[model samples]
Target: MPITEILSYGFMQRALIAGTLVAVLCAILGVFLVLRRLSLIGDGLAHVTFGSVAVLLLTRVGAQSVSLAAIPLVMLASLGILRLTDKARIYGDTAIGIVSSLGIASGVVLASVAGGFNVDLFSYLFGSILAISPMETWIAAALFLIVLVAIALYYHDLFAIIFDEELARSSGIRVAAINRLLVLLTALTVVLAMKVMGIMLISALLIFPAVTALQVARGFRSTIVIAAVCAVVSVVGGIFVSFVANLPTGGVIVLVNAVLFVAAYAFRRCKE
Candidate 1:
């Protein structure tokens, strides 16, 4: 199928729009998360989302309602994780590991009690981009705008925080509050992107692009720009290729990013 023919379909258009927004959201926030050594937070929150979605599904809530409900629940979980790491004796990675395990176990228990996995649950677990509705597209657009505005407003503070947490705190940047805000943004991004990448592979979107860019880019701003470009290209190219090949959209997109990361790694190695 030609590009024009693909865009001619409404579902394809919605998928592209939503995928692009999700790519941007993941790439931009992912940079800071990588710098802050909080990449696992994405994985942890994704697991939390999986469990939350399962609980909602078990209760017979609509998918859209489950999605909406997952946002606050995931954010609260993100905050709780942060608190555990900061206030308690546990380390960050350990806290994330514990929560991740709990989330997966909860999801499994809920799914088993709900009569095992169904198509609807499978879609959330592995994604169903081609099935996205117009309302989901609108929601994604709104989320994109929110992410863009929030990043724009806090760009400098985030930059400072990313570079040196103690220095940022010394400079009155409210490091604790900003860190929580970053986690909150990440939780929102995870939930929204889960619609495209699913719970199993969503963390790749949050980690791969930024890591790929770091392999090549020399400066922070350049790295961010490159990561966003890599992310958007991966999404658009994956969607197109998946349509032509009849492959899984989420899997194809993550594979595309993986390829990009490998290429970037090779390029960096060659340069060195």
Candidate 2:
């Protein structure tokens, strides 16, 4: 479809706006998470998102309300997961695996007990850009702004924590508080992104763009810029391609990001 044709529909316009915001949020949060080797944090939180959303769906709650409700639930889960990883004597990935499995199992049971997959459930799992509404677009915009401002305000502290937690602690940066703040942001970003990337694939959005950027960028600032650019392009291109092909939007977006990562890898290899 032509640009004009795509913009003619209200849903498309809303989806594009929401998707772009989600892309930026995920990309920015992703850089630090990837650097900290905490990429699975997105996956674990997404599973919690899936389970919580399923429970909300079973209760007949509205979509926007469900999204909002998931935020606190996800934040609590994130905190618990972080605490476990930090002090429970368990491997971080092991903690993530346990929580991820529990969340997935709970989601499956909720769906079955609620009489199986409906359009709403399917939409949460796979995503449907055509189903986004104006309200969702607004919410996405607000979250985007919050994420942007928060990241900008704490850029130096976050940078310190990301590279060396002990050094940051010794520097009196309150590493624990910074870690909690980062996890909270990750939880929020995971929930917001689920609408665009789906629970099953949200981690890809949170990791791929940053990793791709890292392949070529020489510095932190350059990596973030490249990641944000790649993320926006992937989201826009995925929406367009999905619209044209009538494919699943989340999967298509992840695929686009994968292709970008591959291209980046090839470019880096050639340069070397």
* Cα-based TM-score, every candidate: 0.97, 0.97
In candidate 2, what are the lDDT values of residues 117-175, reduced to their tens digit?
Answer: 78888788877767877777787788788878888988999999999988998999988
What lDDT is reached at residue 60 by model 1?
A: 86
Model 1, position 175: C-alpha lDDT score: 88
For 234-267, candidate 1 gives per-residue lDDT tens digits of 9999989988999999899999999999999999
Q: Stretches of candidate 1 above 4 Å error?
A: none
> What alpha-carbon RMSD in Å does predicted model 2 have with respect to the real structure?
1.1
The C-alpha RMSD in Å for every predicted model, in order, reads 1.0, 1.1
After aligning candidate 1 to the native by TM-score, how far in Å is the CA of 178 from where it should be? Answer: 0.2
lDDT of 2: 0.89
TM-score between model 1 and native: 0.97
Error of 2 at 118 (Å): 2.2
